[model samples]
Target: MVKELDPSLNESEFLLEALRKGHRVDGRAVYDMRLIELTFGSDYGHVEIQLGRTRVAARVTAEVVRPRPDKPTEGMLLFNTEISPMASALFDAGSRSEEEVLISRIIEKAMRRSRAIDTEGLCIVAGEKVWSIRVDLHFMDHDGNLIDCACIAAITALLHFRRPDVTVVGEEVTIHPVDQRNPVPLSVHHIPICVTFGFYANGELMVVDPTYLEEQVQEGSMTITMNIHKEICTLSKAGGIPLEMDQVLRCSQVALVKVTDVTEQIQKALADDKVAR
Candidate 1:
């Protein structure tokens, strides 16, 4: 389904003029990202991210269950998304929008398909019982760049989350509480971050971290998910204007640099949280 953004003649003209003059309403360069802030909740595996005006929260939880027969050695990793009406007037609580669907797909590709979390490491009893990790992302505000912010929130929450330690004695499973034993962190292979680029004027002009109004006026958008190692997890384009091959390569290169910076930020936040804890 087509997710339609409101069109405004006045806003379009204003943004176009600003871009033509090599300017942005928020005074950021074309490639400059808006300020990003991440806050961890008191509980384990809860994180809130603020990217410019967009806000997203992620909560991570785990449950023990029998592993799938086909993949008994591996645990489970699931991602779920929710968009609140307060996030945007265009959002319907009961229905999933194209943007929401797009976000979920991109995140799943980046996290699950990329194997960011070590599922095999999550196994305690192999085929008998294993931990199933679930990450839930909630859109608190939609100022644009929801995908990038959501990815950051989800991954950070996963990093911050700790699962209960389990001990199996003669097929009996015992889950230890935080007070009884120190919670263990998930074994993460690597982090994959999503960076988006918005195009305008037949792809002549582009910007990073577009505002909501800027998104409405953009001609096309592409999201690239990559890790600090410069490995491309996935590149997603959802019916936007066609981009040149060279343009795609250049954007991927830019995404590599951007993801590296984001990875550092996330690591620093985690380090601080550890000290606080």
Candidate 2:
């Protein structure tokens, strides 16, 4: 069963009315996301993201390793996180908290579901060896939603990272260092962006990009990751309450509309940066 609203009934009702009237508490439309700012190449393989006050940074590195027995021709992608104490009081440095685990799982699920990276292309000599790419996410701020910000950071960093070329001579494989002359980019087929929305009161009150306060009060939420082709890559719904099929479909419709704009914004940012460089 859906839970009742908190004691702040007036504020909640006001926000709901505002949303019904096509205005959010933050003055954005129901389908609008927060302002996004992206910075690439701050370091060798680093990307920084700013979604409102929430900040996340990711650095990617690669190394050659033996292929897994089950997937001999595919490379591996590992996602790690370092939750600094400065980022939030709820997180302590070097400690694996519940939030950290959820963050990692969400990222892993999104990548696996979307098949964003072309792992098979990383194979050097088939079963002999393959490249393993590691992405490290550093949480600089915890404004509200970590999953959305982290996913954005991860995708942006992967897009900007370049790997050194590899050559196989007989039984031996050689990996070259990245320099101005030889730099290879990762095989990324599509760009996926995640959009999250809060559902309340029999799905009557819906809001996009919920703030921390709204997240705390909401009974249920859904997240959708859509690729450049407008395909649904990942869909996650949580909250003990059960929702009707029509409600689920309605959420997907709203989410797709928002993801279109989000993906375009990210692509535009990347393109603009390339032009500036």
Candidate 3:
């Protein structure tokens, strides 16, 4: 849905003012993200995230299922979405559309590119049975830059999630809950975070973590997901306008700076959880 904008401010005028101030409409530098908060759960695989005004909750649940016909030895990662009507009038609880498809793809891309979750470790009894982990993301709020927030939430949740231990004896596997034993964490290679940048009209402005209003009026938008090693995991472009190669490169550089802060925050959150426990 097209977010409503302030009646008094026109897109051109807003861009001009921001350009003069060396800042964006939201009072953020071109590479700054709004405040971020993350919470980790001790119970295997629960995470809560807050990015500015947007919030997302994720839970990781596992079940033993027959492995895919071709890949009998590896487990699978399934991503699902639930956009309640309460979250936005634009989305209906029962409806599925292109928006949902794109959201799923963005999350999947980040997961696949970052290798955030280790699927091979999930196998038990090989061809006979394997654990399938399902990640469910609930978009509680969508203030702006859902992709970045969602990616962060997904990765954090995966890192925090733990699964019951499985013991195999004579081809028989038994599962033990977290309470019975220390749960096994999903193997993660690296943590990656996403940052979004918006390019507006007049070659006059760029903004990071655009609010819904800014996103609605921007000429073009791009998201860059980067790992701690400074490798680009995913680069996505949305909106109707075209972007130059130089512009894209500039955005990537800015994204790297922004993602560094994001990654630190996530790591801090994880560390804080350990201290609390």
Candidate 4:
């Protein structure tokens, strides 16, 4: 398996030096994140998010399927993430890379395991049929922080998604078209946003929303998933440099602030879209 070439020694040194001096090449403060922009498609449940140069698109779709044998009362929420070579040369066309696997797992834990969606609300008939919601995420651009960008896209799309209304009469189930009946939105419990921090200089210098170059040269990183309600969904750090207790707490504080801002933006965008429609 081939890998993308690493940054030159001189380039890494220059970046590290700038970071140590509390200066970011992108002109952002040490703990500042890049600007986030959300764009919705004409069709419901389709959203595109741009975090600086990183771009991700998410689409939500639902289907009627038999309920699981073990949990007949609950529906399903599935996620599929695709990273093509077009997003970055490091990723291949067909196979899954290590980073891809990590991103998928973290997202699953953050969204599904965290119970952000009320799966039981999707049931059309207990033990008979249920709505299976699937979220498809595509990485259009990969500057850095694909995980955070993908999370934003996923939640926004899910909130924007509307499923066809279903009516169950005795043993028969009837699905209504959107034109004939107003579609029903999913029961989203809370939005879990991901805040990723890049560590440098052996964890002394840290920055939020690291760029592609910064990622390649960073010593380690951590991603904290939080909601606007002050709840933590997940905290992921895959072995690069161990962090102190104080560092973890500080990172969590930063994550909360970022999540609050992002949530407000999402709400405002949704309201604006509703008005437009």
Q: Give the TM-score of each candidate.
A: 0.96, 0.89, 0.91, 0.98
Give every collision pair in model 4: none
Per-residue error for 21 in candidate 2, Å, reads 4.6
Instruction: Give the runs in model 4 whose Cα sits over 4 Å from its true position.
Output: 1-3
Q: Which 10-residue window in model 1 sums to the lowest lDDT?
A: 1-10
Q: How far is candidate 3 from the true structure (C-alpha RMSD, Å)?
A: 2.3
Off by over 4 Å in 2: 1-22
Worst 10 residues of 4 by lDDT: 1-10
Candidate with best TM-score = 4
Q: Which of candidates 1 and 3 is the stronger one according to TM-score? A: 1
For model 4, residues 1-277, the per-residue Cα lDDT tens digits are 4777899999899999999899988898888989999999998999999999999999999999999999999999999999999898898899998999999999999999999999999988999999999999999999999999999999999999999999888999999999999999999999999999999988999999999999999999999999989899999999899999999999999999999999999999999999999
Model 2's C-alpha root-mean-square deviation from the true structure amounts to 4.0
Which residue pairs does candidate 2 place in steric collision? none
Best model per lDDT = 4
Report the number of backbone clashes for model 1.
Answer: 0
How well does model 1 score by local distance difference test? 0.91
Tell me which residue pairs clash in candidate 1. none
Please provide, for model 3 over 1-277, each residue's C-alpha lDDT reduced to its tens digit, 9 standing for 90 to 100.
5533443556657765675677776677766788898877656568878888888888888899999989888888989988776666657668875666777787898896467777778889778898898989888887877778888888888887777888999977889977889888888888878788877664346788887767766777777888868898888875657877888888888877777788888788887887888
lDDT of 2 by residue, 1-277 (tens): 2333443878878876776787877787776778988888745468888887888999999998999999999999889988887776667667798878877877887775578999999899888899899999999987767778888999888887888898789999877776534668888988777778787766777777787656766778877777657688877775635678887778778777776777777778778877886
Q: How many collisions per candidate?
A: 0, 0, 2, 0
